[model samples]
Target chain A: MPTTLRDEAAIAGIGQTPYSKNSGVSELALACQAVRGAIADAGIEPREVDGLVTFLMDSSDEVEVARSVGLGDLSLLSRVAYGGGAAVPIVQQAAMAVATGVCRHVVVYRALNGRSGQRMGQGVSGDIITSDLIHWSWYMPFGMLTPASWVAMAATRYMHEYGDCADALAQVAVVTRNHAQNNPAAAFYGKPLSLEEYYNSRWICEPLRLFDCCQETDGGCALLITSPERARDLQQRPAVIRGVSQASFDGQEQMTSFYRPDMHRLPEMERAGETAYAQSGLGPADMDAAILYDAFTPEVLMQLEAFGFCGPGEGADFVRDGALAAGGRLPTNTHGGLLSEAYIHGVNGVAEAVRLIRGVSHNQPERCEHVLVSSGVGVPTGALILGRDNG
Target chain B: MLTPEQKQDLETQIRAFVGRPTGPPSVGRDLVNEPMIRQWCDAIGDANPVYLDPEAAARSVHGGIVAPPMMLQAWILEGWSMHRGHGEPRDEQQRLHKILTDAGYTGVLGTDTEQTFTRYLRPGDQVSAETVIADISEEKATGVGVGYFITTRTTFCDAKGIELGTMNFRVLKFIPKEAPQSAAANADAADAQPQKPTRIKPPLSHDNAWWWRAVAEGTLLPLQRCAQCQKLRHPPRPMCDDCGATQWDHIAASGRGALHSYTVIHHPRFPGYEFPILAALVDLPEGCRIVSNVVDCEPGALRIGMALQAFIHEDEDGFKLPLFRPAEPA
Candidate 1:
């Protein structure tokens, strides 16, 4: 809860396996590979890891992952759900554990063959949510079915109140892709599109387009975390966990939030940003670069608005200056993000954030003081502010 | 043998029993019941904003996420918890039904159910359903009893208690000793067939909304419900052997029910019905089952879970239509 916690903890090492459209390995194998890579990157032995963390959406168990990665023992192992919202929060968990003496060194990894392996976004059907669908049977039978279809209603209404056209959403896809076009690791590398292309794209539900959604990728990313004193001795420049927070707002639904009073306000994101800032003792202007989650391009725009980079609808204008690339104000998704990068839920975004702070990113930004990262938007969200370990 | 007309008549009576009311509701709930709502949400998996976000719910035209329909499934299990199994842990259908109804609850025999979403439920929204007495009947049974059987009817009403859908169920009461001679035999035989449930699919079983195509006449859709929770569940399991039995029964339902409940949508989000189409819950008597959809009738008279007859009617788009018509008053 104290601001000191953020400034005191840092990323000791970061590692990522090759991004892929598909893989021959199991999810656990991918997880172990990423974990070992991170440990080796940190110059730490597997036995040194006292803690572990992963995404709840993953199929691999912690014990199984630890065993596969050759980790001797662990004092703590945890997982955070809420889809992409687990991104930064997992590191925060590792940091919290190390800070509290519950563990020494922590390894956090996310293995997602999210694209060819398990396409969470192909949309679901025929499943009975005794609670959600039973409740949904009351509503959905009336018409709400797919996740995008449900969220589109909210997007349409948001555009209505803000007086912005669907063009406002086009800025995000084009911008993130522009960054991805040059990053070889990106699935969409060299696959750039015009704003007109984004607008003319087919509708999944209503305002959303083909490019507006993220790529379903099969990849894994991992990080090694330790206390500031310990991290400085590691192999790579430690990206300190400057701040992290998770939030859920009142009246939040899974995806269908048709009853919201205001579409512009992502109260969950706002709450997370407020908590992160209060704990980190840093404001938005202090951030040097960010690796925002690009699950849906519009989500990034809304996140910019929530993180206080810009006010309300000004997110479109804030990034319109092309300042999100190298040598610009705060380059984002320099590793291509979920849109271009292999979708590992939000874990890949965390990996990119570390690269930004270490100046090792494929598309490294010019300035690097602080790096910002976020989890999934819409549902419950999480965020973190990472900085170089000064100690 | 039941003529198509006889089956229709029996279905009509079942609807009347479930849909008719006695007086005001014994209990009504609003969205503010967070503790209760939280219990319900965690029980299911409705993490959506339509159920949690206040600002979002307020923005939603419907106010908040309405409770999922299958939520009633919990009563079946909880009822057992109160009783701790039929005096000895044996699965007893009679005992399970009795305790549930004794707790001011009644369930429809769901031969088949389908839901289409135009809107989603949010948190802090007021949702209420009223259980009413719609009609009653008596029949001499040859399969395990020789006595009077009763059908109870009910409907879901909103905060204003607007009719949501009608639920009709058949409760068989025997002369106490004429039990089905082959109870264990029936259980074994039921297992031999192990009919797959038409309601649930793989991976995510609890959130199965649009899982099945419309059924053909002579087609049987297995009654589905959750494993953890029992009541009128959709994804079926013996632990939740919906009617409270370790023994799963594949009852070959007559599949003909009168329109016990009906509604005409002014919108398309409801799934099958577009352009002011009709939808309602029908009561099937043989299996004592119930299901919903548009039926052949004037929209105006399709009052409160009314008893209209049903048959399989699939649209050209490959959606089987659960068509129904009003039956003569019981």
Candidate 2:
């Protein structure tokens, strides 16, 4: 039988450049800066790093990042696919490398000038010849162009089944922005969102208001991983990786997977959540807080159900009466999430999860023991269960 | 070249026909059958078992074989043998075409079409269609010529007199820009104007080129089937996910389906498209779903389980795609 990787590795440090719509610097520069910050935070020499992991969509090459960050000889240089769905898997890769002794200290990072360059919200450009081009051809001609439109196909169905959960969707945006008010690192830190304001925002796609969408941010976020044994000696208390998993279910498409029997659910998240909980010997009740991917507000609601925080179709009720706020039963995305924080393609969510486990987050909840962080929904996704070190 | 007065006179004559019936309702020569459905499936490469296998269809959502929704107009198309030769104008549409030809606008090109179906057509169902002039655009400059865009709406119905669906078809009637007389005089004129952006074309690949070719042919919507497991798949791929068989075939999809979910886009509008595009994920009766635009319906009127049908929209540049619209009650 295979052994569980639970508690084998730990996230020693978390770092990021400021979230901005225009990071005047190059993505490479932002990558190096975030990595440097993580290394310094880990209180380790730059040469101590032996592994590097990131998303395949990342423009920064492993060798270039290694050279820029002064990382020593890398034994495990890896990249995960599915752009926004890669955050937890990137950390999973580095954690596995550390747990297996393939590399002593591994760094995982994602860097992109998402808004200033190559905005993801823009429709598919016609010049590319990639594997995804074929599936896109089916809907692109019909003007199913941007990420918001792609997500809205499912969002519309979700509303139909649940009977217009716009208020619930608005609560996600409101609470996430509300948390950002205290976190200066958040792009919307000074700009709090009201429920009425969320309702009043213009539509990006029907049922998806402009506020429902995450910021098209330009920044980078990174984390350092090492075994629990090594993390004990690090400068800061390590956020132990209790469990982690990546899931891609059958009949999965890139992001336009609208053909499933139930277009409203996230099967990939369910599988990932199940596997992560089994590995950690925990359940939804064990999580003190969460950082469900908020690429869109609807996704957060779907994720709340998929992760078992609420019953199917009960995500709306679970979030009512300021449930996701600082003192609530399950404070989520307390660092503002992708909606108000940076959209580092979800690496920032992982970083925030680490902060929660460390009890040092700007919007830290009072009783956080286990933090559940998830990747982008509506695609092949991943999740993690990070806990405060008991020792 | 016509003077402003002549052009205004022609516009007045053409505009008078707007909202008037273009022709009497025409009945289809044959009832919907399995062979045509199979042919379309073979051409488009669709292989949904519910479309080809009666036994599977009995257990499937549709309950029986049906014609592809994209075949809505195909059922009512006048066959080659029935061509009304180059003689006198037959109906209001041909009469309008003749008047435009007489006015020196000799070029005619099919532009775009929007079609909607209320339900899928099972075998033995006969179809009938009635057409009316919808609208006409003011004279405008196009890449191929200077033309007026004429649009017509056609409503389809069953023999029972129940309303089935409708189509809004547009065409460009123009004078060729490259004609010898205009070439010398307007050589620099055409170059001085900025070219209009074209719709984003689909990327063709070896594995999926056949599917697009069939769509361009405007008769079928094919789904690929695994030779071994007999499972059907869409957006065409080489290998079968079920049996892992490299050998596969296709069947035509019955475009009849209900709306599963959809989105109305309002932001970051792309060039060459109308805003508030009603993009939908429609569940076909043959046990598959497609992503297509639902046309000629208000966003507010859209329902999750509303019935819909598909039609091939041949754009002005002759790009063909499958689009959908709601099934209207008679």
Candidate 3:
């Protein structure tokens, strides 16, 4: 039988560049800066790092990043695809490398000038020949080109089946922005979103208003991973990787999985969540807080239900009355998530989870020992469980 | 603003046409045949073998070649020459248009349409259509100007009087909010402004060029069938993701579908598209879905699972794109 990877590795340090719409520098510079900061935070020499991992969509090459960070040699370097869904899996890969003794210290990072350089929300164009582009050609001719539009199709059907409306979605934005107010690193730090503001925001796609979408951010986030034994000697307290998983269902197709029978649910997420819980021997009831991916508000609602945080079709009810706020049942996305914080393809959420596990988060929960963090929703997704050393 | 008496008169004139047949029954110019079917398949880029290769179609449940169900209206559409009020005006639609035009509501635009298909059309079948006035709205302020909404329902049948489908089409006839500029002013404005670039067309590749050709030929809705698995698919691809079949064929759509889900785009307006664009994912009865624009209905009025029909919208570039509109009551 295969052994669970629970508690095998630990996240020793987390570092991030200030979230901004435009970094005014190359992605490589931002990547190097974040990697150097993470190594420094880990109290490990740059040459000590042996493994590096990131998303396949990331512009910076591993060798370039390694060279800039003054790393001598690397043994394992891997890239995961499916965009933000690679977040937790990247860390999982690093942890596996450490647990298996393939590499002593591994660094995982994601860097993008999403707003300053390549805006993803802008509809696809150019001469791209790939199977994915062929799939997109079906909808693009009808102007259903953007990510928001693709998700809206599923969201509308979800609303129809669940008796939920935009009000429930608005609550998510309000809660996320409210948390952003207290976190100085958040993009919308001082400006909190009101329910009225969320409702009044212009529609980017029907059923999804402007405020429901994540801000395209130009920044970088990096995390350092090593065996729990090594992390014990690091500068900061370690956030043990209790469990991690990546999931994709049989019928999954990027963002347009509309053909599935139950349009409202994220089956892939349910699988990932199940794997994480089984590996960690922890359920939703054991979690102190969570950072559900908030690329769009509807996704947060769907994730809440899919991860067994709530009963099916009751995600809207689960999020009511500041329940996800700082003092509520599960303080979700206490750093405001991608909605109000920087969207470093969800790497920032992982860093925030580490902060919560270390009890150093600005919006720290009262009893945050076991924190759950998720990657992108509406696609192949990933999740992680992080706990303090005592836990 | 109109006087009370004029308002009453206009309302009475518009209301009188209610419940009246809109036009005389019209027959198609040509019988359904293989060439027309092939031409339509080429135009719409459908490669459903059931529409082209008889031998492969014979093995399918459909038994033989059947016209796409969505082609019900297209079969009976009067060609371009007769589209702009040709022949003697006898129907209530003509009289209503005349009244609106005389009253300075000369500007007209199609708003929406709904369609329902009862059966697939076959080659050698002769189709005919008869229309009736459904409703006319009260004068209301709109983005373009003050206008009244006019709706009509058309029923399609074959030469033997067998019902095939029905279409509910609506349009807005209104006076422009801004007065028309003089010809010289228009010319000067045109000269002053750098020539606006043409709207971006869909990128055509080997896999999708046939669909664009169909659009140019005005056959807007088409479906693809995997030659190996015989499964229907859309957003045309060269291979079947299901059975891994590289061989495929095309079929015309029934043009009758329902709004599965939709989104009204309101940000980062792209050129050639109007604002608040209603993009929809339509579920076809043929067991496939398509993403297209839902036209002629208010964004607020759009609903998931609402019945819709297909219509061919001609862009400024003369590319006929398939769009959907809300279905009318039976």
**Candidates' DockQ values?**
0.03, 0.52, 0.33
Better of 2 and 3 by TM-score: 2
- How high is the lDDT of residue B81 in model 3? 57
Cα misplacement distance, residue B177 of candidate 3 (Å): 33
lDDT of 3 by residue, B1-330 (tens): 577898789889989998888767899988888888888889999999999999998899888899987777778877785544423445678778777766767556677899999988888899998999989998877666687899999998888898888889998877655554454322222122222333345766788878777766767577888899988877677889889999988778888888888788887776557778898888899988877888889999998889999988877666677888887777
TM-scores of the models, in the given order?
A: 0.56, 0.74, 0.72
TM-scores for chain A over all candidates? 0.94, 0.98, 0.98
For model 2, residues A1-391, the per-residue Cα lDDT tens digits are 1277799999998879988989899999999999989999999999999999999989999899999888888899999998889989998898788877799999999999999999998867565666788778777788888889999888888888887888888888998998999999999989988878888889999889999999889999899999898899999889999999999987789888776778788999999999999999999999999999999999988898999998999888888866798999899999999999889999999998989888889998888899999997777889999998987
> What digit string (tens of lDDT, one per residue) describes model 2 on residues B153-254?
999999998988999999887876545344422322212232344577778787777887878876557778888998888767889877789898788888
Q: Which ranges of candidate 2 are over 4 A from the true structure?
A: B1-190
- DockQ winner between 2 and 3, please give it: 2
Tens-digit lDDT string for candidate 1 (A89-196): 898788888888888899888887776676777554445344544534433442334455445545544554555545656766777777787788788887887977
What does candidate 3's lDDT look like per residue over A1-391, in tens digits?
Answer: 1267899999998888888988999999999999988999999999999999999999999999999999879999899998899999999899888888899999999999999898888867667777777667767667777888888888988898998668888889998998999999999999977777788888898788999888899999999999888999999999999999999996687898877767788999999999999999999999999999888999988999988989998899888856798999999999999999888999999999999988988898879879999988877888899988863
TM-score of chain B of 1: 0.30
DockQ head-to-head 1 vs 2, winner = 2
State which candidate has the highest TM-score.
2
Residue B203 displacement in candidate 3 (angstroms):
3.3
Q: Which ten residues in a row have the lowest lDDT in candidate 1 chain B?
A: B191-200
